[model samples]
Target: MAAGCFYVSCLALGSLGSICLLFTAYWMHAWRGGFAWDKTLHMFNWHPVLMVAGMVVLYGAASLVYRLPQSWVGPKMPWKVLHAALHLAAFILTVLGLFAVFQYHNQQKIANLYSLHSWLGITTVFLFACQWCLGFSVFLLPWASEWLRALLKPFHVFFGASILSLAMASVISGINEKLIFSLKNSTHQYSTLPSEAVFANCTGMLVVVFGLAVLYILLASPWKRPELGILTDRQPLLHDKE
Candidate 1:
């Protein structure tokens, strides 16, 4: 029950973060006075941080099931280590990135940082995809050879860590951007862009939706059933004994 509640909370936070990002993007669009791709990209600056946090919490809750002795399922070895590492990395990156974004001040140096941050964020997302795929595959194919399973384990763990580091960079860069924007418009009393708040809200809501979708998929997966014999010609152990 605690795990379930944690999972739900994670989903809620993720959703909220997404909504904030969407809102930020909308504000950028309205302020810029044009539907520019560059502006849209800038708006996406907030996503990596929120995503990292959401993933961290989501995985953390799932780990609880594995940790409990009575409820534990599947072989536990390097997988547990890898899982823990990924979660830790995710948390670190998410927190760092959020800090960086909140502290951002737009300047030439900051701009360069933003560029580097964007690349890192993109890389992190890619790694995250790989990790998720590998994890799901392992869950489904528990009977597979240890060697093959082990090969994918490192990829998941290492990539997850890399993603976290990158997410931290991305957040810092985003904050710098915000700071720069503020400095540049010091003389302005109010934003010229109409509906800036509305846009930000919209973007944030979208992010929430995306996070919820991810959580739903993870929770809905049939991890309890082993895939090997479910669809094969293998008979029950009792029949084989006979």
Candidate 2:
């Protein structure tokens, strides 16, 4: 029953994350116009699309690498590598997303990093980078002692989940900020609850739901990765081979 529930939760989490990505992409394409680097507003659209793809969806997926049951029988090194690689990719995309926004602001003569959304977004990225570096050094590197790894493990997991929370909050605020700015002057003002506004609101809600689902999966004791005594016993052999 526990295994079944874990799989079910994983499916739901994947679906929610995919939908959030799609909704963000659709909003940018259908209402805000398609993305392009030369076009400032369109370039701005890439900010949300890439951020949603990288920071929210991909980041959430990476955090679940160890919890998948199919990999329970094998050495965990591969999974660790995969998790780190995914995070590296996500971090790169997130940086590009930030660059797109900054470029847009520069082109438009708009002030940068001046909003609540920007504050949260930049902080999340900074912390996420730090988290990834620390995890890589302690977990993946060869020199770290078991005592140090165990000592840092709790903090690594804590910040992993916390960074996701911060990311979701940043995205939510960004959605609201975009909607307010985009709709304030047009015929379909924000006060009137325009179609774009409605779609964006739905997207934001989906993001929140997805974030909650990820947290639930991470926090559930039943779904946590089991310790691999076999692998631990083979550590000496593995190190000698390395």
Candidate 3:
């Protein structure tokens, strides 16, 4: 019952996070007004929308591959495949989101990768690509040598958690930078909580909440998925060479 509740809470927070991002993008930014690279500033809005949805939310879901109790209830192949596939989709969306930003910057003549957020964002994306490429070529294969998979598994999981943290940090920094740069007024800036500022702050907080919930479930002791059937031992937190 508790595990079920945790899973439910994960989904609940995930939904709330998505709503926060969507509200900021649609209502706060007025994205529907126009979406074009040419002076329709709204086009840049999709960059945040897609990145939040892809890198943060979908990636979070994919990271819960083993945490999903349903995964342990059945053959691991389907769950493994789903994990890789969802990560692939998230990676593609992230690329598109990054491309949108680069295109917008080029069209608007804004300097690229000139901010901390951009630097972190680029590094996170590159790391994600490397992680995916290695995982796809190794673990996803039917004939992976068991010792090799076991040897690399610990690094794989560790790096996965680290990459997610980096992605989250980049997002928070990006949100802060955007609010600071865009929220302009002699009388009131982000501190005063204009409607956009309020929404953006809430959006950032929502993502943070989502990250905590997902990570807690991933790392918590009792919540860890138990092996099925003959393998009754809990998996080691880190793989040890035999």
Candidate 4:
């Protein structure tokens, strides 16, 4: 029952995060002045959309893979494959997202990586890439010995969470920086919590919810899968009935 509840929670939170991120982007894109990064400035909108989808939403789901019950996620080999695939997808989207913003800055003749947010974001992406490569090489490949896999498992789990934490901080910093810069010329005061400001704040808060939910699920001890010794897809957690 606890496993079932946690699985349900993961589904609900993941859906909520994706919906909020998409809605926020839609609101910004449609309601506001619209998009154009090159000459028009639409490129700016892509940054938030991509990051929320790729990092916050997809990455969160990938991180929660280990926590998912066997009934939902299925056997070990496929589960591991799915986990890696999700991370790869998130990495691709994140790279594209980063490129979008940099392209916009270049087109505008503005300096890039000028803010604390950019520095952190760049660092996070770099670290995430390294982590993914190492995970794929060490865990997925038969190249790694059993002893090595055992030694590295905990580090892989914790470091993934640590990198996720850094990514969330970078995302928040990004939202704040973007909002401040965009609103700087507004006749409507941000201090007054105007429509746009309110939307931005709400979006940020939704992202925070997503991050917290993911971290909680990942850390919950009860959700961890039983270690498969020799049998690849066996569920040892479920006791055989007498």
The better-scoring model by TM-score among 1 and 2 is 2
lDDT of 3 by residue, 1-242 (tens): 45556656777967876775676566434613535545345667668877887788888889988876566666778888999999999999899888888888888898999999999999989999999988988889877898898899889888888888887898889888887877664356778888767777777888887777777767876557674433333533222222
lDDT of 3: 0.76
Top candidate by lDDT: 2
lDDT of each: 0.46, 0.88, 0.76, 0.77
TM-score of each: 0.39, 0.92, 0.87, 0.89
Q: How close is candidate 4 to the true structure, as a TM-score?
A: 0.89
- Residues 94-196, model 1: lDDT tens digits: 5444444434423213443346656765566556656665665674446767787767755654554454444444444544444345445555422543244
Ranking by TM-score: 2, 4, 3, 1
Q: Alpha carbon lDDT of residue 67, candidate 1?
A: 29
Which candidate tops TM-score? 2
Q: 1-242 in candidate 4: lDDT tens per residue? A: 55456657967996888776786687568645556656436876787788878877889889887765553444577777889999999999898888888887788888988789989888889989988998999998778999999999998988888878887888788878877877778887667777877777777878888888888877766556666532233343343222
- Encode model 2's per-residue lDDT on 1-242: one tens digit a residue: 55566667888889889999999999999999889997389999999999999999999999998777656666778888999999999999999999999998999999988889999999999999999999899899889999999899999999999999999999999999999988888988898998999999999999999988888878876566666534443122222321
Cα shift from native, residue 95, model 2 (Å): 1.0
- Candidate 2 wrongly placed segments (more than 4 Å): 228-242
Question: Per-candidate RMSD vs. true structure?
Answer: 11.9, 5.9, 5.2, 3.5
Report how far residue 216 has shifted in candidate 1, in Å: 18
RMSD of 4: 3.5
